[model samples]
Target: MFTNPEQFANATKTLFELQMNTFNALTSKAVDGVEQVIALNMATAKNSVKGSVDAGMELSQAKDPKAAMDTAASQVQPAVGGAVAYGEQLKVIIEDIHKEFTEAADHHMAEAKNTLSALIYDVTKNVKPGSENAVDVIKAAIDNAFKGYEEVTRATREAVKTVEQEIAKATAQVGALKPAPKNEAAE
Candidate 1:
């Protein structure tokens, strides 16, 4: 709906730049997420190897089979706890990425909508008298499109909230299941 060739070219260039910027931001975010996951995995692997070595030593030093069994049993709870903590960390990373992406997208979408509205308004101002009805119809369509976008955005936000709540609940449950004291186990 641009009036001049220059206007159309400028608009096209602006849209292209916006898309490129968005792509770069998303790619950077993905890379960060990957880095986090790699770091976490490396740390987890290191600790696991150390733990295994230490456990082996402890078992080797045990005077009897029963003592070796006790040593192994003592490591179970901590291993499970570590696993749960790792899962929670992953969840946090993923949620953070999703949030950042959503915020960026929302910002870009709003900017685009405003730009489009302004362009439409400018174009409509130059229309002849008989074309008023067509302009009105176009404006109405644009309004409806915006309304639809808002509704979808709202629903997506609600869904994200629900998923976050569920993850929190599950994490809490796992956290609550700490191992009982050795003395208690004896009883």
Candidate 2:
């Protein structure tokens, strides 16, 4: 029934692209959680540093006994250490999340490619003997399928870039806090 080879290629391409987009969308939601974790870590780190610096300054200026400064320093040290640990752990989490998405995408992409190949095989096998028209139809279908894949991939990549930008912004904001003056009395 496939008279136009080009039309068949287009259809196969459309189907593959459609499915790929659906796959990316599902993965993105998962990736977003990782982004949030990173964001939260960053925010925590910034706040910890700011709080520590503020407390240290206040204690140091109070002319509090050496013991008071020591005590405040001791308290701040653990918060700093915790923030550092959390940030590192978050990085590992993001890497793992990305790995998972890549693996899933690879598997689905292979399946879609295989489905295209199978369709080609079926068209070439079951068609009436010496059907030149069928071969042409199959070729056209394959070509269209590839074109669709390219389009969908390009569009989704742009979207992914946008998400990446958002992630970056969120992380950057986490460390944007201004540090307290090293010499408070000078002001």
Highest lDDT, which number? 1
Worst 10 residues of 1 by lDDT: 14-23
Q: Which candidate achieves the best TM-score against the true structure?
A: 1
**What tens digits encode model 1's per-residue C-alpha lDDT throughout 94-127?**
6996687678668766876786677677658778
Candidate 2 ranges beyond 4 A from true positions: 1-10, 13-18, 21-30, 42-50, 53-61, 65-76, 127-187
Q: Estimate each model's TM-score.
A: 0.71, 0.51
Give the poorly placed runs of model 1, Cα more than 4 Å off: 129-178, 184-187
Candidate 2 lDDT, tens digit per residue, 81-151?
A: 55455545555555555555555555655666776676666567656667868577766767576566556
Cα lDDT listed for each candidate: 0.74, 0.62
State model 2's lDDT: 0.62
